[model samples]
Target: MILLISPEQTDDIEIKTLHQLFEAGLEHFHFRKPNATLDEHRAYLEQIDPTYYPYIMTHNFPVELTQEYAIKGIHLEERKWREQGAALETYVKSFTDKGFAVSSSYHEPEDLAAQPVTFAYHLLSPVFAAISKSDMQGRGFDVRDIPKFIAGMGGINAQTTPEAVKLGFQGVGALGGVWNAKDPIQAFKEMQSAFAKAYNKKI
Candidate 1:
């Protein structure tokens, strides 16, 4: 899947554009507005068409709230998985008991290798030159050893998506590649197409 991550800040225009993207078949949207308050998050969810709620995944929220918003799941930051240690297994199981899909992030292959808690997917950043952050250089990461469910993030777009999928990533996350585009919805559509073309071949 092509996961579209939200910009840290949102405006009315961006919210409307996100609706358009959902209508255009954008699945797995990681709704990560870390700075927004819970009330603000509620307001944002209220604005989105409820029919698209199932396509969203919130970052940094209580799992119970996912039920309230009908969100598909929650993505914990990499630090949580690292610091929680063995406690993560029981913590995540609680979510699974309620039928929530869990995900997390990683900065390197070694971190993923060391992680014992399984997730629906894990986002590995800086897989390519970061589209949003200039300093997080891509370094042309070789991803052969990572699990298939780990997603490649950072600077991914239509051109680089196929290669990431080919390298064994089950998914990819795009921030600047879409939100920073002249047309975010169109950028998402291209990303969807690229992911389908690449993923279909592996089957």
Candidate 2:
């Protein structure tokens, strides 16, 4: 699973490239626009071909967006997950019952291990130095012992994706690695190919 996260701010070029990416076999697009309002989010989705709606996972307005669009799933940011407290399981279940994939993010391996609520998958970050944020350093987390579908984030690209796999991530997610490249679509394909080769070797 090579998940591509949207850049914080929207750009016309990025949107156009995203259409190309979807056509080029990209799956699991994390539609995260933190600063965008619900209306803006809807506008963004409207721009994309509705046929690809099932391939998107919204990071904001999970219930509302998923209810309106046939997106793949909802991602619970660490803060939102923590806010749920005891209701976390029930909250997650509500979506899972509807046959939606529920995933969450974690910065620490220990925190992920301690999490009681099961997710469709877990996104562990800073496995490698972050490209989008210069100040964030990589922790090189090893999730081999964690019994869940884990995807590594932070500085993931064609070159570093395999390293994440070797560290035991079942999948990898990226943002800058793809959007920052000169050719976003080609970068995605390369990263996708690299992940597949590495994951195959791991098994």
- Poorest stretch of ten by lDDT in candidate 1: 139-148
Supply candidate 2's per-residue lDDT for 22. Answer: 92
Candidate 1 per-residue lDDT over residues 1-203, each given as its tens digit: 78899999997698889989888988889988899988888888888888988788888765546758777888888876777776899988888778788888888788786777788888888888898998888855667676547788988998899988887788889999999999888888898899999999977
lDDT agreement with native, every candidate? 0.84, 0.92
Q: Any runs in candidate 2 off by more than 4 Å, and if so which? A: none
Q: In candidate 2, what are the lDDT values of residues 1-203, reduced to their tens digit?
A: 98999999987687789999999888899999999999999999889999998899899999799899988999998999999999999999999999899999999899999998889889999899998999999999989998889999999999999989999999999999999998898999999899889988888
Estimate the lDDT of model 1: 0.84
Q: List the residue pairs that clash in candidate 2.
A: none
Highest-lDDT candidate? 2
